[model samples]
Target: MSPLPLHAVAIGDGLTDPATQVLTKPQQAFAFGLVDEKQLAQAQALAQEAHDLALAQRYADAADKRSAMEDLVPLGARNLPEA
Candidate 1:
């Protein structure tokens, strides 16, 4: 016989309850500095562009969004050891 669906067991355990999935702790942001005003502007422009792109593609699938979101990470957080 085919194995029972694993998700079937989870249904009775309040797995779908919104309260059971409440956040105990949410992430706080990390702080950093940019190299200069030019870099800061570059980062801001990148963010605005990403925001606009997401807005324009608001109906796109989640996988496309996951790909689009890689740019959302600030450059300092990405390439620098610390910033």
Candidate 2:
């Protein structure tokens, strides 16, 4: 079958491409035929990649929020107000 990108094809065994590594996990898997998806189109696979990326961002955001509330950051010197 012809490749989706039309230019990212890798021939022969034991060969690798830097371009492939740059692709998202789903994209790489789909491109390399790691998963059976005869009914799945490349566009749909790309959409799945988008979905996964969005989900990853959510996890990262949660981690960021937790870090913000944690004592991981060092507090600088300050003065106390008179009581």
Candidate 3:
């Protein structure tokens, strides 16, 4: 099948500690793939790089970065999963 248009796509991936709360998990992944203009492979590579860098830090630091990124997204765009 042909690839979907970038505007038609919504992709997300993240790592979480086993004890992380369920509702918060999606929010963490949201920072990676949402609102990207890059091709999927490039986006995935960047996300992998971010994930690897995050993994090198303490969990709390990574979580803080995710939260900060999410905050930068406008409210309308932040509601993707709800739609």
> lDDT tens string, model 1, 12-79?
43324222121110111123442345544444444444445445654244224333332344544443
- Judging by TM-score against the true structure, name the best candidate: 1
lDDT of 2 by residue, 1-83 (tens): 88576657655432143223222333333444543354224424443444444456654544343333222222331111111
| lDDT (C-alpha) at residue 69 in model 1 | 33
Ranking by TM-score: 1, 3, 2
Alpha-carbon shift of residue 17 in model 2 (angstroms) = 20
Task: Select the stronger candidate by TM-score from 1 and 2.
Answer: 1
Question: Which segments of candidate 2 are over 4 A away from where they belong?
Answer: 1-23, 38-57, 60-83
Candidates in descending lDDT order: 3, 2, 1
Decide which is better by TM-score, 1 or 3. 1
Stretches of model 1 off by over 4 angstroms after superposition:
1-31, 58-76, 79-83
- State residue 19's C-alpha deviation in candidate 1, in Å: 26
Q: Go through the candidates in order and give the C-alpha RMSD of each one to the true structure.
A: 10.7, 22.3, 14.2
Which pairs clash inside model 3? Answer: none
Give the Cα lDDT of each candidate. Answer: 0.35, 0.35, 0.44
